[model samples]
Target: MFDITVLGCSGGTLEVGTSAYLVKSSRVAYQEILERELTDEIVAVDCGSGLAKLCEIVYDELCGEGDSMATKSLSFYTKDQVSCLEKFTSRGIKRVGMQLDTQCESTPMQVAWKLNHMVKNYLLTHPHLDHCSGLVINSPSFGAHSGKRVHGLDSTCKALGENVFNNVIWPDLTASDKGSCLQLCSMEDHVPKAINSTYTVTPFKVKHGELTSSESYASTSFVISHRVLKRSILMFGDLEADDPDTPNEGLNWKIWQHVAPMIVDGSLRTVMIECSTPNVDANQPLYGHLTPATLFQELLRLRDMVRSLNGSETLEGLEVLITHIKHENAMIPDPREVILGELTELKTLHNLEVNFTILLPGQTYTVS
Candidate 1:
């Protein structure tokens, strides 16, 4: 069975103990299973702290401890604050932030802090709150406001270890005593504490077509080699490319050909690619997103490329899991499944030999 667990595909955290989940490849040893693996540390790709509410906390401080404020949009703090206001936080929340948004199917607002805690390593696909909010280590607020940003919280840069939480967009969480203004984390902060694993995480910027070329959501790709469990799952936060000016115009295949082959170059056990829509849906997949049809075409193209390269590594029967379905085409009952069904049928017809799975909400698949 898969050690993975899906919290939500297109929305909210499943109620605790809900069993609407899947386990794909669970082959852990008796002792491994006896010892809980998931823990409380997280790897966040993005953090979107609401400003109006955050400022209100500072506003309350200026107004005086019990002083009431007119409006409190939302503060990025814990729930133990003053009267009439509740903090927006999860007990296990981490302060790891990045320069992106969150996943559409992202509900926990985190990628998961503790994946089998016995293994302390972590990986995040890109900068997005839905994927990273669960792991943010800290936020940077001015000390004048309260001796520290989100005052007195231990989520400062040093406390987080190797970061200067980017002051460009978010405040510098590092203390002035640390000698840095910015507070963003470096690559070192991502590796796990132990477990004798060869896991490595790397990010590469990818340009999507016009349809997906929005600013706040620029796409970045993630390649994680989870050496411990011998698992590797690659996914981009959220992605898209601009369809040409013409409605019928599609992604530039020539450019894609150049990059596609390289994507499989990395050695991995399993690769989770994001396929968000059906080809007829019109959005370009792979810029940071993938439509079922586009994904089909891309895979075929990739298979052919691999054959031509004369490489023995064939994904013909390789397990390929698809994630990040758009609200319209997702397996869920939204209005978009009409065309989605057609696209899924096409995939079935191809019977591409590769293990294809459309990840469901709360679903977990093994890594075999």
Candidate 2:
């Protein structure tokens, strides 16, 4: 149903695709659906602000960060960022950007507003500061600007907390026609992509490390199910793998029961999940990430689960790809190949027979 592409694995925003959504926090990866047929239907999830900070910090080492021109006249917020909203919105004929961030800077707020104020346009999924970060994407100086017919699934606003915008964290900027357009719905209150669709999308909360461990900040993971294609993908945005039973040891359980069932339910042919470290050695705490070996463990568990669920003696040959590898670790001469080799070793376990790949930005997978 969809051609899966990996933008960046380590959950930060890396400029490796035509349309980018950097999951900028502890959960590090982004995906792009590069179907030439769906150009007008582009969708982006979360864009991490942590990426802006990291980019600037490593800019000189990577030959300098921040667009010299975009930053020249733009008012400064965080060090490396430039206002991309105004520049983007003005050019917007018919394009949609879903920002899934905790905050929307002042400048982007003004620029993001679709130019036409009176038209009652609709928002597809839910709109959060992250889901609508483009408001400040071009960095329009915040003030009263244009508004569009903004729609959200029933209770989208409630999920965000009634006064999320008015609080200290968000821009809290709304157009004059906000209330009128907000009440509109597409029949059911759930996300359009969640129910009956060619390609299915399900959003649920998962724990991931919080570099910015503020109350205002939180992260969630999503599983994309392409029914006709018989495949599923779960990306934990800044996901942490801790289990309540193992409280002191925050494993960020990558293979939780809820997620596992979903993966198994699909007639999945290929799968990709985050493995944030090269080895546990990458970070001693290992609080919010999984090692390649652990990812392998999960796949083995899932393979068996699927077999039992179907009550079939045959296994559907699960192809699991380990992703969200950090750039510094990935640069270590043939890192992905090393990870792949390890996954191959795991295939020897009984009837597991899993195929795996370590993700590098801009990597693409075609599921037949």
Top TM-score: which candidate number? Answer: 2
Candidate 1 Cα outliers beyond 4 Å, as residue runs: 11-122, 136-184, 187-197, 208-217, 228-231, 241-269, 279-288, 311-314, 328-332, 335-340, 348-351
TM-score of 2: 0.50
Whole-model lDDT for model 2 versus the true structure? 0.38
Candidate 1 residue-wise lDDT at 250? 30
Residue-level lDDT of model 2, residues 1-368, one tens digit each, is: 23333323333233321122321111111111111222122223332222232233223122333233223323223356544423311111211112112242323222122211211232323333433443223222223443222333344444433544443545444423433212222323213253333335555544444545553223445555545544555544444445435533432343344455554554444455666555556337655556666665555555555556566633344455565544343235434445555555655654465555443333233432
True lDDT of residue 184, candidate 1: 33
Taking all chains together, the TM-score of candidate 1 against the true structure is: 0.49
Question: Residues 255-308, candidate 1, lDDT per residue (tens digit)?
Answer: 234434544564343455555555643532344455666566666665665666
Which one is best on lDDT? 2
CA shift of 212, model 1, Å: 10
RMSD of 2: 12.5
